[model samples]
Every structure is written in structure tokens, then in C-alpha cells.
Target: MKATIERATLLKSLSHVQSVVERRNTIPILSNVLIEASADGAIKLMATDLDLQIVESISAQVEQAGATTISAHTLFDIARKLPEGSQVLLHAAEGKMLIQAGRARFNLSTLPRDDFPVIAEGDLPTSFELPAETLKQIIDKTRFAISTEETRYYLNGIYFHVSDEGQPVLKAAATDGHRLARVTVPRPDGADGMPGIIIPRKCIGELRKLLDEVEGSVAVSLSASKIRFGLGSAILTSKLIDGTFPDYSRVIPTGNDKLLKIDPRSFEEGVDRVATIATEKTRAVKMALDRDKITLSVTSPENGTAAEEVSGAFQGEGFEIGFNARYLLDILGQIDSDLVELHLADAAAPTLIRENDRSPALYVLMPMRV
Candidate 1:
């Protein structure tokens, strides 16, 4: 196999595919990326970790059509250190791969391309295309709340499904039992009758990074067991969690009439300042609310107490509530708009938060007892 590609372009494509390669691999072939230089003047880089896979193709001047497997990390590192604007020449023969850029030349061991596990896309019938920005919004807003607990494997991913609320909408929801985030976007035409799927946490992180570099629309296809995202020259495929997501609609509070409208930035800043004195274990902050202002305070047995005040248009009788400082800051950081509303019933009940009730995105946070 022989191909020549620009250093910058090769580095970008390598960065995308190599991330799917696990550093600690039990199988030697899994540590390598399958480089296939086809006759059509392009080279495809593929990497996988059994559960997830990424394939990226870039335009290259291909003189020969062949395939080879070389160390993913080795190739990425070489591409990263190569001079800017340089052309990278890759040639594989006699069980070795040669990388040449400017005056630097390196030879690396190559594995048989046949040894690389290429997951076959059996049949992904349900497919849809959504604008990149909307997909980015849905993912970024909810992924932070994804659970890390492995015992409840089902809760460790974002649950994606189409919801029919007068109009069909695509909803992405994530929770860690303490906090829940649900975001909705207008459903695409082909998404009707699609199966609900839980995209694992790893896939979410990788896909979110890819979406940052994508524009226009992204094609998505899925079956009951797998989901695939096509972002132009890059494709990501992953296995779906087999467990059913819990009915989350019941957890959202409906009767919390106590309302507070405040600048999310200010509230988030206040939480950061007060949390400085909070206990590391609990990381709890207390909020005392009145008609015009909310006092954010924290108490630590080892460290002294800290407090700050932020003004808001809070309705209903004044009440004090406690919540995890980290959780409060996380939800606030996700708010893109200036104004945020909080609906509260009491200190013991779950609080509902959004830009407003009409907003497509909603959050439910379980209050912590400080």
C-alpha cells in the first residue's frame, strides 16, 4: 500500500480513529488501525475496541491499492509531530510500514489486515438526518447527567427516543439518580417508529467531539442492537445497551408552584463561591430564598462557613433548600440563555428547572440534606 496525504489532514483523521483504540489491549490486532488505500485516491483508517468502532477516510494520492494494519498510537504520534504543511508518505510491504515526512523516516511493524475486527453492519433500517447543531444541542445538554454506576448498566447512557407530544420530537435523556436532564428537538421525517436506544457513555463522548467539527446535517441509522452516526467522511458505530430505560416521566415534578427566575450565570457563580467552603464529601450548598434574593451558603465542620447573595424574582413563601454544589453548577452551566426558572415545592421535594416551562429542555435535581 502506498499513499501520500497532507500532514494536517492525516493528523485530524488519525485523531478521530485512534481514540477508539484502547491503550491496554488484550488482542494485538485491536491496537492497530487498518489502513486501506483504495484505487479511488483515498485512504481509510479504521479502529475498534470490540464494542465501538470509528472509520475515517481522507483524500490522498494513492499510487497502489492495498491494505495494512499498523499501530494506531504510533501512526498518530508520528503524524502529530510531523512538520506543518508537509506531505506524509506511507508505504507498507514485507510485513513493515514505512512513514516518511521531510527528512524524518520511521519503520513500524505491521499486522495482517485480515486480523483487524471489522464489525459488519448487518442492517440498520431505521435512519434519519438531523441538523448538526441540533444534534449537538441534544447531546451536550444531557450527557453530563449520564450515570457512571456499572451495576445499573442501563442508566449509564443517554436514552434516545421519539416522543409524541402533539408533534413528534426527538428526546435525549440522562440521569444519575441525583440529577436528571431531558432535551428535545424536532424529530426528523425518517425517525418515526424508531426503537428507543441507550447510547453508551463512551460513544456519547466520542460522538460529541466529532459533532464539534461537523456542520449541516448528520445521517444516523440504527437497529435494535446497534446505532451508527455518519458525519461526512467519518462513521461511528456502537452496540446499544440491551436493558430498558425506566419510565422517567413519572419522576418529573408537576405541582411545584414556587417559582424563581434568576440569571443562571449569576447563580452558577454564587454556587462556585459558596462551595469553596463546602465539605468535600457532601459538597453541599444551602440556598435560602425570599421574594427578591437567594442566599447561597455552605457549612463545613473542618472549614469555616461561606455565603453569597444573588437577586432573583422568586415567588411563593420563603424557604431554604439544600443541594449538591456540583450538581447545581452542572445544570446551570448547560443553560445557554440568561434567564432560568426554578420550581420548588419544599426542601424535601425534587425541584424542576428550565429556562421556562415551555422550554424544550428540563432538569430535575434531588435536593441534598445538608
Candidate 2:
């Protein structure tokens, strides 16, 4: 197979597919990307790691129409280092692939295209289209809370299901038996009968990258075992985790007795400064909510203590709670509003956080036992 493609275009396509190729692999073909040159001068690149797969296509100049598999990382590096807009020539011969760009030439080992695994597209029971930005909103808000614990494999993904109100809802929840984060997106139309699916953490990561390039609408195809996302020039397919996510609705506190509103940035920065004195084990910073002001303080036996006051817009009944500083920052970073609202029942009850803008996003934090 022989084809000529622009260095930039080739590099961009390779960049998207190579990320799916693992660095270490037991199967020889899994490390390589399948490149096919069609008669119409279009080049396609595909790579997979058994469970996840990516395929992308770009325009190229084809001299001979055929297909070959070559190392994704190596080819990407070569194309990336080459001069911009330069024409790159690729040809496969004698179980080796050759690359020529400007004055530089490279010969890479090749694998048989037949050995590469392809995920079969099954007849999806449900299919829908939604804006890529909408999908991204659910992912970015909840992905951080996905648990890394292997024993509870089901909690390793964001759960997408219909909410109790019969609204289409997407939720991400994770717990190390300590803290939990839950984010939901209102269900779009055409997803009424869709069953809840646990999207793996890795799939969420890759989906974020794909959505960045997509705007209008992304076509979604789902089966019992797999999910496919088609974003114009690329296709992402991955196996869904087959397990049940815990009932996250119960964990949210409905009886939060105290409500405090403070500047999101001020609360974030105050926690950052005071937490420096917090014990490394607990990382707990105590918050004192008084009339029109919030005080953040942390005291460590060996490290001393630090305190900072952040003015608030309300003067509710004073309440104090201890929380992990890092956790507070993580949730606050996702809030785009200037003011953050914290609802508290007591130091023991979980605190509910929401932005003043009445956005759909809500975060619940379990206070650290300090």
C-alpha cells in the first residue's frame, strides 16, 4: 500500500488513535494501527485495546490502494517531528513499512492486518442524538468522583439512568467508603426507555477529548454490552461495565438545616491557605459560618494553626463543619458561579452544595471525622 498525506493531517489522526493503543501489549497486532487507503484518496486509521477502539479518517493522496498495520506511537512521533505541511509518503513491503517526509526516511516493522481485532457493530436496541456539549457537561462534572477501587468495579463508572422524577438523568458517584460525588444531567428526548449503563472511567476520559471537536450533535448507539459514539470524523466504541451502581439518591441530605452562601473563589482560596496547617492524615479544615461571614481554620498539633475569614451574603445560624480541603476545592472548581451555597443539617449530616445561579449541578460532601 502506498499513500501520500500531509504531515499535519496524518499527525492529527494518529494522535487521536494512538492514545487508545497501550504501551505494553501481549498481542503483537494490538500495538499497531491499521491504515487503509481507499480509491478516493481517503486514509483511515484504527487502533484498539481489546475493550476500547477508535477509528478516524482523513484526506490523503493514494497511489496504491491497500491496508497495513504499523506501530501507532512510532508513526505518530515521526509525523509529529516532520516539517509542517510537508508531504509524507508511506509504503509497505517485505513485512516492513517505510515512511518518507522531506529528507528523512523511516522503516517500521509491520503486522498482518488480519490479526487486528475489530469490534462488531451489533443492532442497537436504542439510538439517539444529543449535543456534544451536553454530554461533556455530565462527564466533566462527575468523572472526578469515579472510584478507583477494583473490588467494587461497578462504582468505577458514571451511572446513566432515568431520575426518580422520570427525567432523563446522568449521574456519576464514587465512594471509598468516605466521600461521594453525584452529578446529574437532565435526560434528553428519545432516551425514555434507555436502561441505566455504567460508563467506565477510561471511556469517559476518551469521550471528553472527542466531544471537544464535536459541536452540533453526536450520534449515540447503545447495546447491552457496548456503547458507540460517532463524532463526525471519528468513532469511539467501548464495553460497558456490567454491574449495578449503588442507590445514590439516598446519600443526599434532605434535611440540611443551615444554609450559607459565600464567594466560590474566596471559599476555595481560604481553604487552600488554612489547609496548609491541617494534619496530613485528615486534611480537614474547619469552617465556621456566622452572621455574614465564614471563617476557615485548621489546627495541627505539630504544624500549628491558620485561619482566614471570607465574607458571605447571608447571616444564618452559625454552624461549624470539618471537611477535607482537597475535596472542597475539587467540587468548587466545577462550579462556575461567583457565589457557592452550602446547606448543613449539623456537623454529622452530609452537607449539600449548590451554586446561586440555580444550575442543575449539586454536590454532597461527607464531613471528615476530626
Strongest candidate by TM-score = 1
Model 1: CA > 4 A from native? none
Q: Local distance difference test, per candidate? A: 0.93, 0.83
Best prediction by lDDT: 1
Q: What are the per-residue Cα lDDT tens digits for candidate 2 across 1-370?
A: 9999988889888988999999998888999999988989998899998888999989999999999999989899998899988999999877998999999999989988888899886777778787888888778777777888999999888877766555546444555445566666666666667778888888888889888888799998887778999998999999989998888878888877677888898789888888877777759889887888888888898888889998986545677889989888888888888888888888888888888534767888889765
Indicate the residue-level lDDT of 129 in model 2.
Answer: 82
The residue-level lDDT of candidate 2 at 139 comes to 81
Query: Taking the tens digit of each residue's C-alpha lDDT, what string does model 1 give over 173-242?
Result: 9999999999988889899999999999999889998999998999999998999999999999999999
What is the alpha-carbon RMSD of candidate 1 to the true structure?
A: 1.0
TM-score of 1: 0.98
Listing every candidate in turn, what is its Cα RMSD in Å to the true structure after a full C-alpha superposition? 1.0, 1.8
User: For model 2, where is the 10-residue window of minimal lDDT?
Assistant: 168-177
Candidate 2's displacement at residue 306, Å, is 1.1
Q: By TM-score, how accurate is candidate 2?
A: 0.95
Candidate 1 achieves a global lDDT of 0.93
